[model samples]
Target: MKSLIQIFLVSALLTTCINVNAMTASPQSWWVGMQTNSLQIMLHKQNVAKHQWQLMPYSGVNLHNIIKTDNPNYAFLNLEISPSAKPGTLVFNSAAGGRFEYSLNARKANSSKRRGFDSSDTLYLINPDRFANGDSTNDSVKGMLEAANPIERGGRHGGDIQGVIDALPYLQKLGVTQLWLTPPLENNMPSYSYHGYAITDFYKIDSRMGSNALYRELAAKAKQHGIGLVMDLVLNHFGSEHVWMKDKPTADWINFNGDFANGKHATSHARQTIQDPHASDFDKRQFSDGWFVATMPDLNQRQPLLANYLIQNAIWWIEYADLSGIRVDTYSYSDKAFLANWTKAIMTEYPQFNIVGEEWTSNPAIASYWQAGKVNNDGYTSSLPSVMDFSLQESLIQALNEDESWNTGWVKVYQSIANDFLYPNPDNLLVFADNHDMSRVYTQLKQDLAKTKMAMTLLLTTRGIAQMYYGTEVLLDNTGSNDHGDIRIDFPGGFKGQKSNAFTGQGLTIDQRDMLQTISTLLNFRKQSAALSQGKLTHFSPKDGVYSYARTSEKQTVLVFLNKHAEMKSWPLHYMEEVLGSQIHATELFTQQTVNLNKAVTLPAMSAVVLVIE
Candidate 1:
């Protein structure tokens, strides 16, 4: 409504008052010598698109194009950095007086050749908010919508990255080679943000948890102790509190026109739609583009700009934090084409890096479809390296809880592993007894210590990469409730007012101490066994209440027996002659005593027997 002269003067004043540091830039920094020569920087400021951007004279660096979106506050600078470019500050000046300096830093030596987690590693999943609280000062961070409320089940409990850093020694001693923490990114929701699934900011860590620098520090410290870090990422949806929910970059930045009807736009969770040949377009849309919950807005990755942003963000975290792996939450919920491009970009950058997606289906056919090397009828090629073995997890729990029958008990486990042929690389799958989203294995087995032992032993000695919930070693239980907060209980001695200390083995119940020893023994042994980690598996059909298998490497062979009987059973060796290979003697892993393999081996009731034949 103002006159031309008045508006001109106001615009001039705003440009003169512009603070380059105050304006935000996605990938605020960059590095030279990346695998890709193309880089896109999204600049966000008041009327940022109004000014034409120019790059100061720098060798081998050129501003190829500037993309101005529908939003006047956003500008995308497409840059091409040739190999001749050196590491330095890039000065970007606007037509007016506004200027911004972006760093083009040097990459770490051989950064692209970094190795990721594999079958040799044991992943321990920790819900950081419930793990430990090393710094109480940031318990109630200012400006965060939800404050610390330890008494409330769903409220934040103040566990920060520093706590994880402090526990590296303990975790290293426990023989876990990899740590998979739930999303530690910013989740500025009104409540129940402690679980860290609904991320508000993709680039920054939650202030209540810790700063981005502290997260990098934890990764470095973990690496020093022969441990790797696996970051959990949510790609399908984000917290509604994210800035895109208000000032969107594009008209279709969020799916379904950014509208969340009361349970109307919710996802059908029909994961099979992605592979079902008979799926209708309506069903596919309902499963893929629909919102997860009212508080979470599904992202429209089909938009090329947003797709580039997400792909770049993931690579940025890997480079910035030196992460060893990534675990994608709700893997199949995003646009399949975008997921393919996203993973292909990452794997192209770091060919050896590992990424495991959470398909969360008991059907091996559906879960295996997402893994790399899968040949699908629809010609959908995935670059994902691994998928969680939910089939084995569900089968293991049911096997222990059910009575021995022709189709029950040990047969369930045998049948579960029998389905491994469906996987392109079964050894790459992640096997776990329980995770943050479900009841603890101890509770699922009705607090039967023997069955828990059997389950842990089988997981540790079986095929695929093994992951255990944080407090599984201590038998953390949430028997009566299916609440998420209860499933992800705080570790013993992590917070104040805890009677038992799992770290120090003080004041723990005898059963807890025993279970801890069982887990520690298996983990330590597995660390040295090439046979157990990545090996050829041979199994016999389930006979009576026993299921047996052998994992054989070039140098060592590991024999495992899971007996669900009520009394000790003598398992014959003739059934496994091909796997045993005329070995006369073997050492029991638990007792460390040599036994003659010419006859039958004794397996205790409701227990596992793991032996090494070298």
Candidate 2:
């Protein structure tokens, strides 16, 4: 472990920009292709904005525009590449006594054809810092401000990309086709940098996590394992410790730029107001520009240079890592105009790529407004393929906790699913019972094993792309606290010497083992079930404490039954006659038991049953 750290440190020292001030170009390399015909090269030097810059020669690339920001230290050179421009180095000579050189990296063949995740894929969300620590040496790098402290609930826990790479086999066995990792870029804040949301360097992966190359390695390995990688991105803000924070790129590079001196701002957290037509200009301004906290600064994407920089950063990641998709954080917080361009640009570059935005609203109307085909009343349009299904998530949890009654129990869930029309593509929405930002499903269900199983069944088999947080298979829970540190705890057996090993199924309770097995069984079945993935879904409203739905395709039909009662009984099966189409019998996937569909179906108390109609 010590030797690995030594090698990592040596490697870091040998390559890449640890110091942005020393480099002529912000990004040392960029892509050259038809999709990305023009490149915006940002040069940051002492008073670099004061002078004129030009291309060193009339090569295949032509200098289009040199944009100067209010901040004298930063300048943007917009250059267009001719179709004949071969991938090579292009130098920009400036009167400021420095020449910025940038390498035009060759785009992989069929780069624009990379496909992103869809309903067929299930995402396993992992917080890399807490998932596992594959290497011990990088736990506490010499110069990094925050050292690894697993004891401190909110501190860095030493998990990195390698830990994830090593756990690919376990994920494959669990049957998730995609891995949605939290942001891994450099979050060089003085403390609480483990979340990785407060990115200090966009181009550089955090050293604690390993190099940027290692991140790509994780992506490549995941691909080989039939697992797609969904990178979490934050375009709304950056850590105050970011290099650009010290050097003013423009007067409006950051919202409330003066307030950033101290770090915190008077944010309203009124997320819905961004979509409200009745919202006052002052309130909208406050919500959009307000600093997130003392350590994170809200970016002013209205500035063209800053907007271009962020959009280009997204492109760089897609090409560099060959990512399956991106999960945008705080999606609506960015300037609306800038966001439209950001999403449009990415889709233009890779037409098949998918991007899901987090709007975090429980209103279907509010969330639907962010989907690609939404025709907004205010004339706002979104290029986003999907959105986090917060409305369905809230209803699912609420429906389970309440007793069966009119608009009380299963009806709440039925209504939520019925609201699917609000979205352009409901199946594309990222659906989950819980995520890193919320309580775990186990705890959210009040630790009731039966209810938890029911929740998992709906998430896995029902409409939409499912996303299960890591440790969900084993019933990970935060029983008493709402703190994020408590929510994202260590996986029982991910690290070495843990007495409880989820991987090996040692030190696990009978209940934990049961839950784990049940989750595994359903996931593996869903992996091969075309009906579950590509079928048309039709559900009946809840009656007699049993709610039912069916996902049917040309080849198969899966009938899902949910019974909320405490005791088993043969409920009326007449409602499914039409969907089953005279099929009198079916086989339960989980138990392999055969039952007559013509008669009443008997199921366990508070249980979810997936029956394949013959």
Candidate 3:
């Protein structure tokens, strides 16, 4: 017993001495620390005697001045972890008698899954202020323009980023793959800038909408749920009340500061002169320097410092938010040279990033000039990857509104696309039936549900990225006028005490639910269909009121027919025989019914059919 007690005492003393020596010998030169709501870290020490790692308690370890320590230590690190650690780990070696080594292994505590956006995404474009207002706390900000009034169409209704973040599941159920909120940058104009066009600060998110950190969290949360966030950016102008405007950075900080040039009427013929080498500088300045409104001052991209600042601001947002894509507003108004450089820099950092520019020209030639890869007559180069298909929107509107005529009427869309040769790559174009600037698609089609469905079918099956304006699923309308304020009315259920709520699908007429379901089904179907994305497009326009197209890929083929005849008509097989290529089987995508392509398929008046060839 005495001998055993002596051995135990000696062993304890040796262990204590060794531990003290190990801690003192190589006073840790480096340490790791982490603090994030989204992740956590765990530390483990290697036990060579046990031939395994033993978990170390680093919950409250201090990591300041880590690099000032003496010994070198190796540690394994994990990212996007969870379960929370107060500090982290530090490891060192003992050199009391002989050299001893210690190392650390950092394993992720809990990791969330990763997701990516894809081509089948049905983008929902929302002006957040007009969407929903879940929180009324931040309605009135300090020192900002405009008061929050839910009843007023043009006033800030307190619809914020948090509101949208709260409604993600509602959108997810509606089969929305992406969300495109309008510009949320601070717009500090005294009044009527609630739409966020007049940016006061590029770096700060509009306080009414949310904080920068909140926006980043929104993006991270949206990504976790398999949703893509598209940021709306503006490079053309800043709010006249912008702080920099009060104290100009340089003589050329703003374009034509000596005399403010009011905006000129957008004429494609006149604007196309921008690409002409012989065009007078007066004409160029008129287009580039002119202000969109008295309250919005055109920015001078020619100023090198301002240009760099704008470019860096865009990159900073992308990096900070890990954004899926960008939508540049007023794409053509900026300097052509500056746009090329800006786009090149963004594309360099994010190779797969997507961007859609708003050219807002109905003429394909004028619009195509701004799209990337268009070889201009004057050797003008552009780096823009995509453009909003304004031509398609114009054609769709005219088709729905015009009376049937010999060479006009619904055939306008067929002819419009026939001139698609103007575009170098039409597939990259963003096709939308309506946006914030235009009359709602439902109103344009005279509130005809069938026609609205037909229009949406065309947009979804067409050979370009499709974007749906918010409230299209529920057939939201602007009543009659196309005034800006009237066009961006408040969304149902966006505010407290609202009689209707789009999020809950309450107070909606049966017709509204039917339209919403139609959109939901088609969008979900589109999520799985590659033909709508990667397929080759072949279209035919044989008559004034009839149009058809086929999208074929390696695995599938889809046929779409649009008939705007006042009466039902049977479409002959020969019209689409070239694309059918001896079709074996066909099924309607919307109705899920087998279709007989060999027989003349009768279509209802002003109706469309999307048939999937099996």
Show model 1 residue runs off by greater than 4 Å. Answer: 1-18
Error of 1 at 371 (Å): 1.1
Candidate 2 worst ten-residue window by lDDT: 12-21
- Residue-level lDDT of model 3, residues 1-614, one tens digit each, is 33422432332211111232222211111122222221112111222112122223345342221111111221222222233433333332333232222222232231112122335667789998888775687788887877787667677878889988988888888877788999888987778767988998776778888877778778888877778888999998888888657655556777776235444522122565577678887777778777777677788898765676677667556655667788999888888899998888766555667778988788888888877789987787877778888888889888877776766666788788887898888888888999998889998888888889889988988888889998898889886788877788778777777687777889988878888888888787777788887888898763757678888888889888887777898777776767788785788876788878788887778778788985
Tell me which of candidates 1 and 2 scores higher on TM-score: 1
Candidates' C-alpha lDDT: 0.90, 0.85, 0.71
Worst 10 residues of 1 by lDDT: 8-17
- In order of TM-score, best first, we have 1, 2, 3
| Candidate 2 or 1, higher lDDT | 1
Of the pair 1 and 3, which is ahead by lDDT?
Answer: 1
Q: Of the candidates numbered 2 and 3, which has the greater TM-score value?
A: 2
How do the predictions measure up, each by TM-score?
0.96, 0.95, 0.79
Q: Whose TM-score is greatest here?
A: 1
lDDT of 2 by residue, 158-216 (tens): 89899999899988998889999999999888899999999998888899998888988
